[model samples]
Structures are given as structure tokens and as C-alpha cells.
Target: MTKTFTENDVLKYFYNEVSKLEKEKIEDFLSCNNALTEFYCELLTTEELLEGKLEKPTEKTIQNILDYSNTLCLQN
Candidate 1:
């Protein structure tokens, strides 16, 4: 049986979450379909941008989390 792929499947392909067979099928499908290929490209660009923009929480944010945990522990 032939399986049809969706955007979700393409995202799985992007993250290497799909099985080897599914990955091969998705790549073949993307090669044939311009629109789906474009969507996949967009996902790639968005992922790269997100990776580039990653940042750790501020010290204040970490302290706030610890303070909240302490309050919860006191209440317990």
C-alpha cells in the first residue's frame, strides 16, 4: 500500500523521528512535490533560526523558580 505523507510527517522527517523507510519515502515525495518541498524548506529555516536564538533563563528567573520551590516545600 502507498502511504500519503502530511506536514506532520515532514516535520518528523526534519527531526529524524521517522523510520528509515518513512524517511526515504518522504524524501522521494518531497522531491516530486514543489509545495511540500517548500514547506519542508521553511521548516528547516525556522528550526535554524530558533536554534540560533536559544538563550538560557536569566539569573533572576532561576532564583524565582528556586524561591517558588522553597515556598512549596514549606507548605508541604
Candidate 2:
């Protein structure tokens, strides 16, 4: 029989906040449930993005702001 996980179980899984055994259970649920898999995937993506490891803006955009600042320097 398949074990059912609760929302808290899923949340803990997403945050890597659960014990190894619980994580294993979450993995089992994710493997068998499409909705859970998608939820897990989105949660992982959000966590990664929050960790500054995803969707970083381009370096050129940063450089452009610096360049614009240089153009605004006060004339002596």
C-alpha cells in the first residue's frame, strides 16, 4: 500500500528540513505522484533562486549601470 504524505511533509521535503527517512518517503511520494513531483520541482526551483544560484541577471546589465554613473559625474 502507498503511504500518503501531508502538506507539512512536502514542505519539509522542499526545504531539506526533514530527516533522511522522511526524505526517502517524500522521494517515494514524488516518484509516484505527478502533482507532488511538479510541486517539488517548483519548490526546489524557488529554493535555488532564493539561494542566489538561479536566474542571475547578466553581467552586462550591471556594467551598464556603472557606465551610466560614470557619464553622470559632475564636471569640475
Candidate 3:
């Protein structure tokens, strides 16, 4: 029987969480489906944009976390 893929399966493929055989199946599935391929492309673009926009927490936030941890340690 032929397999049908869902958006969830595509996400699994995107994250490389699928098995090798499943990855091949999804690649074939995407090749035949324009809409799904477009969706996957959009996901890729979004991931790129998100990666570019990602930032580390500010020093103040880091300090606050350290201070809180110190307080917790003192209480124990």
C-alpha cells in the first residue's frame, strides 16, 4: 500500500527525526505534491528567518537568574 504524509510527517522530516526509508518516502511525496512542497519551502524560510532573529538573553536577565539561584541555595 502507498503511504500518505501529513504536515506532522513533513515536520518530522524537516527536523531529520524520520527514519531513512520514511525520509525517502516523504521526499517522493513532496516531489509529487506542489502544495506540500510549497509548505515545506515556507517552513524552511521561516526557520532561516527565526534563526537570524534569535538572540541570547541580556546580561541583566542572566544576573537575575544567578541571583535567584543563589537565594534558593541559601534557603536550602
Candidate with the greatest lDDT versus the true structure: 3
Q: Which 10 consecutive positions of candidate 1 have the poorest summed lDDT?
A: 1-10
lDDT of residue 44 for candidate 2: 80
Tens-digit lDDT string for candidate 3 (17-66): 99999999999999999888998999999999898887789999999999
- Give the top-scoring candidate (TM-score): 3
Candidate 2 global lDDT = 0.82
What TM-score goes with each of the models? 0.68, 0.56, 0.70
* Per-candidate clashes, comma-separated: 0, 0, 0
Total clashes for model 2: 0
lDDT of 1 by residue, 16-71 (tens): 99999889999999989888899999998898889988778899999999999999
Each prediction's RMSD over C-alphas, in Å, is: 3.8, 8.1, 3.1
Candidate 1 clashing pairs, residues 3+ apart or interchain: none
Q: Candidate 1, residue 25: CA error in Å?
A: 0.6
lDDT of 3 at 21: 96
Per-residue lDDT for 1-76 in model 2, tens only?
Answer: 7779876789887778999997887888888888877777888888787887557779999999988888887542
